[model samples]
Target: MKKIAITGATGFVGTNLEKYLKRSYKVRTLSVRYVHDQIFNITDDIIIHLAGKAHDLKKVSNPQEYYESNFELTKQLFDAFIVSKADVFIFMSTVKAVADKIDGVLTEEDLPNPQTHYGIAKRQAEEYILGKEISKEKRVFIIRPCMIHGPGNKGNLNLLYNVVKKRIPYPLAAFQNERSFLGIDNFNFMILKILENKNIASGVYNFADDEVLSTNELVQIISETLNKKNLSLAIPKSIINGIAKFGDLVKFPLNSETIQKLTENYRVSNQNIKNAIGVDKLPNTAQQGLEQTIKSFSKK
Candidate 1:
């Protein structure tokens, strides 16, 4: 069995991947407080670096938080990979590195113009890794995945689920928008496939559940999964947009961050990931994954 090193094992993505990896490999973790020492001998091992600064909702996170955790930490890890002679290195980056708001379907070709400090920091790390020199035994990959959600995740999706569970009508029903998200199941599968498939070229890739769900569709899924009536109103979008504008002016809860999330067309394409995995099939559809997550949410 091969040796595997993972950072952010406590995070949703890393924890999900570890479930399968621990069964067949010598799995190790690089704790949040430690770096470039001890069990982190990357020699002849696979390193999946998942630790990074997550996007801050309240905009309270300092700019240095992103650089120190995302860029500097990754830099330290990559330097260790070089010294320890690692074979494959996977960096868990985010779609925000490419664009914070999307006008259409996001692909690997889009030039990165990250708006937030978090995105900027991740993008900087990506640039640094891409600029490095490597020998025959080493490979590097930067994977930018959209919002990842799963059963145990307590993210925006779960918040939406809770709000819907309370039968609170979503105010944004006025905006018919589509967005993409990665199911943790599919993400775990993709990471494993990428690690195993040597023919897949080393570079950047985007991962997401294939189906694009509108906000209303997402609410309906939650409602049905929890056995509630689909209670939504399709009010005119103009009112909602105006309200969002006012929210921004007042720094209200439905402020710029929330508006961008609820209305942005963050439809990232999974073609590069599919091509790398040497298949057109995804392990789980968006609906299936969402169902599983909502079921878990109800139990909690």
Candidate 2:
């Protein structure tokens, strides 16, 4: 079996990926504390870099932490990969690296203009990798995945699930928005395909499920999953905005940032990656994947 060395092996994605890939590849983890020279010493045939500082939703993390973990650490690792015998390197970036507010379906061709420290830092790492002179023998993949969810996921989706479980009405149902999500199963499939296929050209590709879901539709799905009636209430947008402003003043839960996150349009195109991987569709539909995730939450 081919050997694979992964960074961030203890993370949500990394743990799942290591388990999934162990059937076909000999997987090992490189410590996050390792320097560039230490990374270069690994004898793995593939390197999957997943270590990075995630976006601080609470806005309490130090600004320098993102740069150090995402940009600087990736720079060191990529430099090590350049000289190492690793034939494949996969860097896990995010859809936030491109744009915060999507005007339309986000494609791989879109120029990056990341706003937050997290997004900006990931973008810088991506730029650094692209600017390098890679050899023909090596393949580098920079995968920018949208909001990822699965059995272990405990993100915004979980928050939504909690609201539905508690029988709370979804207040922002008035805003119709579509967003793309990447299921962990599909994400695992994509990486395995990339690792096994040597003919696929290395490039920046967006990863998302085949279907996009509106927030209201998502709430309905949650209700269905829980065998409960949907309690989504469509409040007027103007009223919601006013409430958000009040929330900002009072430091309440329904603040501007939370509202934007719940109603943002973040449709990402997975066409490029699908084409590259020689697939017409992903393994799971958007609804199927989300239902599975919601079910997992209920068990907890």
Candidate 3:
């Protein structure tokens, strides 16, 4: 069996991916921390780099942390992979590397203009990886996955779940917006397909679920899962804007940035990846996967 080494194996996605891939491949967790001029000794046939500084919603993390963890660490690891025996190198990037807000459907064709340190750092690593010349024997892929959610993930979705669980009225229901999400199962499927097929080509691919859901729809789904009444209040958009501005003054969590995140059009196109993988549809639909995630939250 082929051996796979995964960084950030203890993270939400990493833990789920390890379990999913171990059934078919010899999987091992790799502990990687950023240090200058550090040498990585890798012998696995496949390497999935997942360790990186996540986006800080609370805005408390140091900006340099993103550069060191996302850019510097990846540069070092890719350098190691270039000389190592690894045939496949997969870097888990984010769609935010391209843009923080999209006016239309985000595609691979769009030029990158990242705003946050996290996105900027990831973009730097991507440029470095794509600039390098590689031998025909090896393949390199930089996957940009949008808001990924699953059973054990305690991301923004979890926060939303809690709000709905407590029967809080969703105040952003008035703003209609659509966003893409990546389920852990579909994410693992994509990774396995990339590892198994060499014809998929080595390049950047935007990964997301097939269906897009609005914030109100998501709230409804959570309410359905919890068997509670959907308390989505259709407050006026102007009032919400005023409240957000006031929040900025009061240092409330519902600031302009958070409100924008709650209501934004971030539709990602997974058509390129779907074509590359030769699949018309992923194994799990967006609703199905999200429902599963909601169910898991209920169990906890």
Candidate 4:
């Protein structure tokens, strides 16, 4: 079995990936962090770099921490991968590295103009990887995944699930916007397929579920999973805005920033990755994957 070394092995995605890859490849979790001139000991045939400073939703994180952890650490690891015997290098980048709010469907062809420190740092790492020259034998995949969710994910999806479970009516249905999400199963499938197929080439690929769903649609999915009636109120945007502005003063969870995040258009296209992986459809449909996620909530 080909040995694979995964950084950030304790994270949600990394832990899942380590379990998934263990079925075929010999997988080992590597505990690594950002340190200047840090030399990595990588004896595995494949290196999966999943460690990075995630985007801080609270805006309290030090901006420089993002650069050090996301950019500098990735640079150090990639440098090691290039010189080591590893033939495959997979970097887990985010769609945020491209745009904060995508007007249309985000694709690999879109010009990257990141707005936050997290995005800018990741983009810098991507640029550094792309600028380097590697031999034909090596494969480097810069994967940009959007809003990844699974059983272990404790993101906004969990919050939405809880709201639906409590039978709280969704009030922001008026803000009709589509967003893309990636299921962890499909994400694992994509990574495995890329590792198996050398013809996939070394390039940037955006990964998302085949279908895009609106926020209303997501609430419906959560409701359906809980076997409850979905009640979505099409409250006017102005009313919601006023409430959110008031929330900002009292430090409520439904503040202006949270409301914007709760309803924003972040559609991403998985065409390039699907075409490269030679798959017409992923293993899990968008709804199926979402239903699975919602069901996991009941177990907790």
- RMSD in Å for all candidates: 2.3, 1.3, 1.0, 1.1
Q: 1 or 2, which is superior by lDDT? A: 2
| Alpha-carbon runs more than 4 Å astray in model 4 | none
Please give the lDDT score at residue 166 for candidate 2.
Answer: 95
**How well does model 1 score by local distance difference test?**
0.84
Q: Clashes in model 2: which pairs? A: none
Candidate 3's residue-wise lDDT over 114-142, tens digit each? 99999999999999999999889999999
Give per-residue CA lDDT, model 1, range 1-300, as digits (tens). Answer: 888988899888788888878877788876754343423345548899998878987679878888988988888788879877568899999999999888888998999999989999999999999999977778899999998889898588866787788988777776778888788888988888887778888889998999899888898899999899877877677776777799988977766567667766778899988987888879899999989988998787
In every candidate, how many clashes are there? 0, 0, 0, 0
Select the stronger candidate by TM-score from 1 and 2: 2
For model 4, name the residue pairs that clash: none
Q: Estimated TM-score per prediction?
A: 0.93, 0.97, 0.98, 0.97
TM-score winner, 1 or 3: 3
Once fitted onto the true fold, the runs of candidate 1 whose alpha carbons sit more than 4 angstroms away are: 32-44, 245-252
- What pairs collide in candidate 1? none
Candidate 2 segments exceeding 4 Å error? 34-39
